[model samples]
Target chain A: MKVLALDTSNRPLSVSVLNYDKVLATTTITTQRKHAAYAMQTIEDLVKVAKLKPSDLDRVVVAQGPGSYTGLRVAVTIGKVLSDTLKIDLVGISSLLALSLNVEKEGQLVAPTFDARNDILFTGLYRITSNGPKSVLPDQHISFEEWLKQLDQFDESIVFVGEDVANFKARLQAHFGTNFKSVVGIDNLPQAARIGIYGEQQRPVSDIDTFVPDYLRLTQAESDWQKLHPGEGHESYVEQV
Target chain B: MKNENSLILSFETSCDETSVAVIKNGKEILSNIVATQIKSHQRFGGVVPEVASRHHIEQITICLNDALQKAGVTYSDLTGVAITYGPGLVGSLLVGITAAKVVAWAHQLPLIPVNHIAGHIYATNFDHPIEFPALALVVSGGHTELVWMPKEGEFKIIGETRDDAAGETYDKIGRVLGINYPAGPQVDQMAHLGHDTFAFPRAMEKNDNFDFSFSGLKSAFINTVHHADQINATLDKNDLATSFQQAVIDVLVSKAMRALDKYPAKEFILAGGVAANRGLRERLDQELEKRDVEFVKAPLKLCGDNAAMIGAAAEMLQRHGAKADMSLNANPGLEFEWAENEEE
Candidate 1:
């Protein structure tokens, strides 16, 4: 089973072509705001290096949102189009989970944090078990302080994984001290192989058209409009307006 | 599935519309699917870039599938993938560009990057072939420019708006009337029903340069309505719309005629979203007829952002051997220039 996985939900863009559990080829490019520019080209290059045609791929996996909005759209949009066009299944993996896959040790908590700007972070907690990473905390958009407060309950040492880990490293140390640990260097970046493996273990989307990026937050316009039309959560902003 | 007929799949997501098309050879559009977000943006009174990007990603795949299925063509039958790569909101443009790049690279098909304005100009070709040395007046929500195309597929910006675009000005003025978001057509409709009452200033009409300035006119219109409200005077909505539309049309027609007189061309094509304006189209037709220059008004549907136009422009690029590689990025300000320096 050939699976093509893509992860551009963060600063580092990663693409991997895998044959079931075996990795055939993987490519990564670390450049901010260059994911959309390099994403498809990297995927094409990876497929070429793997000596396979686009049609040879059986499934497509993509790291869905909770990271950069444009970056997530790049992967999800292409994944949907490719899967639909190639008549293959498409699976969406949490970007937070993909980041957690950077942690190699078992019996440790993998806490992936993506900077959401203004001191807020899109983060989640996952436990690294022998059977892949298991979700311990659902993806949430909260302030760093609030997120740290929620993590106080876990007794195990936590390994924060993600490109933005460095940004909050100092604050994280102040919060949990010795209990808080982070993977430094390349291991911190999310990889497409991780997305592929995680997706292989998950179910494919039943309807490709309905599947979209999991943007945890609303657009500024929508948020503002919602504020004006208070208590109109059930209705769409357009309809309420 | 490679055959004598080369099918080019195209995408356009420069703004609130997510469009996909399958064009056979350039002239024939097998299928053109446009999923517009106008309804979604109507509440915002204008296009929100973030909202537009979100819609494009969601609608692109569906549009692509529909375009292919409607055309009854498979990926193997495709000759290339063409996409509008710029002169649009970055977030919106990236969705289409990324989608195009992926499909092109995945299938090993050539990718053709098309300028949005070029797409609008080529949209007129769906009805008839554009004559060389054509002077095209491109007007849309984001742009208002006079492009001098000396030969087929060559573009030269003769003049452009210095301030608000003609369509943008109409929208801003239309907001006072509580009209729908895109006010070009609404103002045009009201213009046909009422007389041009108020004398709105037509900026840069007497100037020798072909450049336009609509900011002054827009402010004048806004001030007129606001002043009337202060004085408790109820102004006629239709007359206001008529006068504003006339002001815009006067400036546009004047600049276009100036460009045409300076550089005589075989054809004068009116393209872009504002080309759908009834008053502007009629005026251009009358003037071009007097000059004996063939007038081509873009089809109302083609005047807006769509993939068929991108497909048409891509055909010209393909003929000129202007295939974009995987390195092509979505340029927010992708400009077009004359390609006379390149070999055919």
Candidate 2:
């Protein structure tokens, strides 16, 4: 199976073409440039390097959100269009799970984090098993301090992964002391090759038309509105209007 | 797939609408599917950027599918892909751009990045073929500008709003009257019911430059309502609406007349969401007829943001060799590039 996988959920963008367990070509760029500007071109280049055309790909895999709203849309929109147009299988891998895949260790607790600004982080807990990174706690938008408080319950040594891990390393070390393991450098970045491999084992989205990134949090406007009308459940305001 | 026909798949998610269209040679719209978020934004009193973006992502693919199915064309039949890339909410614009770019890349088609204002002006093409040197008075919720097009695909802003857009002012004033968001249509309806009692000031009405300023007029309208409220005097809403509408129409018509005398365009185009105002359209039509200039009012249904207009504009841009690669990004503050030697 030929797979084209991409991750534009954060500042670092990764694109890869894979054939089953083999990574044909992969590129990861950590830059300040918007993912929208270079994501399609990066995918095209990686496909060319893999000696494959976009049509040759049987499945499109993407690291679906819990990251930057614009960044998530950039990848998800591309994924949706490509998959729909080419009539191929479309799979969405959790961005946090993709980040956790960088840790190859078996039976190690991993916490993948993306800095969501204003002291909030899009973080999740996962266990790196031989099969893949299994979700111990699903991805969520949370405060860094609050996330650490929740993590304090686990007695096992936690290996923190992701580029944003550097931002909170001091507090993490201060809290967990020697029990905290921060994986720095290239391993912290999301790998599309790993995402493609894992996604290959997953089921494709039943309906590509309704596929959307997992934003993992409500927009500030919605949150403010919900606060004012407490009993109104989290049903979309778009539908009500 | 790859037919001889010039079929273009277009997208317009610049603001509150998620629209997709199939244009044949940029003149005929086979299918133009517009999923509006007006009702969704009514609760917030205006479009929330994040909410708009969310709605756009959800509706883009659905619109694209409907557009293709309605047009009876597949990806292979499309020669190019076009999208509104600027002068809108960045988050909202990116959804369309991302989708367009992927379509272009996947099909190995030319990608045309269209300006939102340009799309509005070209919407007149659906009514009649635009004759050059055309003068377009573009008015909408986000913009108010006098665009001068010397020839096809060339855009230069001759005049513009110094403050709030004409439609934005209408919404702001409407909020004071307990009307819904997008107050232009409601205000227009009310204006026809009553006389212009207040005769609100027309800011920069006689200015040498074609620039407009509605902030002062907006403040004055607000003061009038507030003063009445303080005195417990309930002013007639129809009269208030009439007065405000007259003030806006007078300034717009006067400025258009002045521009027509100077530029001598064969066609004068009224476009954008505010262009749908009945009073403004009638006033411009009367004034343009007196000047013997051809008046091209964009089809009312096509006045608001839509992909059909973007598709129409893309045909003109493509003729001028306007194309973009995968690196194109949504420019929130994008404006028309000044025509050479036309910059003030």
User: Which has the greatest DockQ?
Assistant: 2
In model 1, residue pairs whose N, Cα or C atoms come closer than 3 Å (at least 3 residues apart or on different chains), thus clashing, are none
State every prediction's TM-score relative to the real structure: 0.95, 0.97
Position A69, candidate 1: lDDT: 91
- Report the C-alpha lDDT of model 2 over A139-170, residue by residue, as the tens digit: 99999889988998999899999888888899
lDDT of 1 at B53: 92
DockQ-derived CAPRI band for the predicted complex in model 2: medium
Task: Provide chain B's TM-score, model 2.
Answer: 0.97
User: Which 10-residue window of candidate 1 chain A scores lowest in summed lDDT?
Assistant: A232-241
**After superposition, candidate 1 runs with Cα above 4 Å error:** A230-241, B1-3, B338-344
lDDT of every model, 2 decimals: 0.87, 0.90
Q: Can you write out model 1's per-residue Cα lDDT over A37-81, one digit (the tens) per residue?
A: 788778878888999999899999999978889889988988888
Candidate 2 residue lDDT tens string, B151-239? 88789987899999999999999999999899999999999999999979999999987888999889989999999999999999999
